[model samples]
Target: MSDDEVLLSHDDGRGVRTLTLNRPHRKNALDDALWRALRDALAAAGEDREVRALVITGAGGAFCSGADISGGPRAEHPTYRMRMLSDVALTLHELPVPTVAKVTGVAVGAGWNLALGCDLVVATPSARFSQIFTRRGLSLDLGGSWLLPRLVGLQQAKRLALLAETLDAEQARTLNLVTWVVPESEVDAFTDGVCDRLVGGPPVALAQSKALLNEGVDRTLRDALANEARAQGVNFATRDATEAFAAFAQRRDPHFTGTWAVPPSLTDMNGSARSPGPGHEERLRQAD
Candidate 1:
């Protein structure tokens, strides 16, 4: 499919790739074309060595209002829509690099699950999330049943899904569903800032860390520790690690070359801290 068919726009600069859903009139609703475009964009970004971070956002105002209900796409294969949506969600989860979802407005049903697929979510104060499937006599799609439970816990997930209630940005933040809630006008800036930080960090370290964390969710502590140690050994041999240590000794910032083999220790490693890298505390403090 050609780029124009996807209603997706991509921009890359300074190791960051921003993909915007361009179907504004439909509130960037999910459709087969849109999903295909999203998958392609993500794959493109992942394959590009220059791209260190990826940010997904919707054009115009709304993030996404769930699947396109205007007939064409959904009507084409009603029963298969569930599987298609789940495939899209799984594709997002498989992204190799760090991904951030920037929500400026409404994110309902499948749209909410799409944002949850990203590693981090930053929403504007005007943003709202809802699981409206039950209200429409439909079940959750796009891996919502699996993803939501792990995110906000089974009970809270059930309450939202069953009630089909709208959750504001602040409420979502309190539930730990979003990383930050900024003014609507600041959404782009905030997302860009996050991308900048990710791009500046050690690439191999970040990727390994993300993988380990994702894997740890289902692994035993002993297995996780062994996996982490292996990851550390792999990363220890990378040029990025050499630079990291050198920078530490020089009391200067590290400039990574992106050719390093990811360390196994970096994967499966755990710490009490929620965020990664130095100055993470400062970022949280600023958020507070």
Candidate 2:
């Protein structure tokens, strides 16, 4: 496939962008070029105000098998190569839009971490996951070390990483790793439904809530409450907030436009509406 085909992007005209990893031959493994492509796609999605939701999935039944070790020798230094992965990971994690990972077959090594980076994960009954790093004679990369512990607790994280144990979809759900275990036939429809709800929600409020939850983990209760106050203050200044209150009173569904209704003078002490924004890895010898 040509470079453009490494990662395929689709916009459904409903504010949902689906990014499919298109390399079926290698289970959509990340080679340098594919990594770059994924990173760029995610970056573009983040910047596009029209994109309210993002979905990541793999073509050909498998999510990904981590890095493409079979790819030929690399001219770049290992650190430099790792920087590419780091960029992709950070971009995905920090993306303002909600993201979903639709997993079918195996998501191992960095591939699993990639899915974990998303806000939600939907996997089929037959889907499988593994840290797969130790088995490859390496340690976790692509934010696995950080994501796993927070997701499944430190002990479970260590077990997965140290043993490189593969877990089926149900088992992963039990560990709180997979958000939803769906049947293959219905998975697509189900995921589309989820995205629709997300897309229909108040965008500014959802973004604010996502940021609050993400930051709440590391913050003190007092600090979290403070942040929540600020977030709600901003939310109330959006047209969406008005629509929601009106909808509630009218007993109808609210149509959120995500438009900022705050006057330029109110959004900032200096009378500027601008607000400060809130703030991956490589293959083995290639490593994931």
Least accurate stretch of 10 residues (summed lDDT) in model 2?
279-288
What TM-score do all the candidates reach, one by one?
A: 0.84, 0.89
Off by over 4 Å in 1: 5-13, 72-80, 261-288
Q: Tell me each candidate's RMSD, in Å, in order.
A: 10.1, 10.5
lDDT of 2 at 198: 96
**Candidate 1 local accuracy as lDDT?**
0.80
Cα lDDT tens digits, model 1, 97-209, are 89999998899988888898899999998899999888777888887888888888999999999999999999999999999998877877878888888888878778888
Per-residue lDDT value at 80 in model 1 = 68
